[model samples]
Target: MTSAAGATALVLALNKPVYPLYVWFLAESAFHLSLLTALTMPLYLAVWHLSRSGKGRAARLGMVIVGIVDTLAIALILGGESETLAFLFACLMLAGLSFYRSEVWLSRGLVAAIFVLFVALEGRIGAPLMPVEEDDMRSLAFLNVTGAAALAAFIMLRFPRAERPD
Candidate 1:
C-alpha cells in the first residue's frame, strides 16, 4: 500500500511537463513510505506473535484500532482530493479487507473502479473533479503522503501473517 501510494505520487509528479519541486516530491514520497512501514511493521509482528501464543483478544483489539486509523486517513486524503468515487471504492475495499474473511471480491471491485477512474480522468469523461491549484499542489501532496502512510499502517496491521504454532 505504501509502495502504491509512493508510486502514485511519483507518477503524478513526473506527469507534469515542467519539473518543479521534483526533488521534494520524491523525497517526501520516500519519507512517508518508510515512516508508514516503520510505524506498522512492529505492531503487525507483535500481533502475529500474540495470536500465535493464543492471545486472540489483544490481537483483535489491535486490528480494530488499525481499521479505525486506516478509514480515517483514507477518508481525509480522498476527501481532500475531492475524489468521491475513489473514496467510496476505498472505503468499501478497506471495510471488506478488514472485516470479511474473503477479500478477493473487494479487491476486484476496487481494481475495476480504479481502472475506470483512471481511464475516465485521462479521457476527460467529465469536468475535473477538483480544481487544479498550483499553490495548493504541494500541500495536497503532503496530505496525500501522510494519508498514504496512515493507510499503509492500517493495511499492515489488518492483514498480518497467519499465526501458526511451531
Candidate 2:
C-alpha cells in the first residue's frame, strides 16, 4: 500500500508540469491528486504498525477501508471515468487477497461494498468536480491506468504462494 501510494504520488507529481499544456483543469487536478496520495502514506504506515502489533484483522480491515474510501473519493473527484474505476476493482482484489478462508464473510462484504459503490457511481456522475478537456481526459486515463495496474501488480506479487509438494 505504501508503494502504491508512492507510485501514485510520483506519477501525479511527474505529470504536474505537463498538465498545464493540455488543460487548466489538469494542473489543479494533478496538484490535488498528488496531495491526496501523499497524505495516504501515513495511514498505510499506521496500518502496517497495526499488523505488526498482532492486530491482523483490524489492520486488514483498516487497509481495505482506507483504500476503498480513498479510491471512492478520487473517483468522485474524477467523475465516472473507466480509468478511475480501475482502482475500485483493485480494492476488490485487495479485499479478496487480504482475508483467509475462515474470514470469507469479511472479504465478501468488502467486495460487495466496492461493487455497489462502483455501480452506483459509474456513468451516474454527470461531470467531474474538476472537468478536463477531451484530450486531457485521454492523458489522465493513461496515467490512471498505469497507476492502477502497477498497484494491482504490487498487491498480487505480495500475496503468499502455496508451496509445491516435493
How large is the C-alpha RMSD of every model relative to the true structure? 11.9, 5.1
Could you tally the backbone clashes for each prediction?
0, 0
lDDT digits (tens) for residues 19-109 of candidate 1:
2243235433323222222233344455445545565445444443443343333233323332223323333344344333454565555
Q: Which candidate number has the best TM-score?
A: 2
**Each model's C-alpha lDDT?**
0.39, 0.64
Model 2 alpha-carbon miss at residue 72, Å: 0.7
Q: How well is each residue in 1-166 modelled by candidate 2, as lDDT tens digits? A: 3333333334333443543343334534444443444445556566666666677777777777767766766666666652677788778877887777889998999999889988887777555675566666676777677767877887777666557899
Report how far off residue 40 is in candidate 1 (Å). 26
Best by lDDT: 2
Model 2 TM-score relative to the real fold: 0.73
The candidate 1 region of ten consecutive residues with least summed lDDT is: 11-20
Model 1 TM-score, all chains together: 0.32
What C-alpha lDDT, on a 0 to 100 scale, does residue 83 get in candidate 1?
Answer: 29
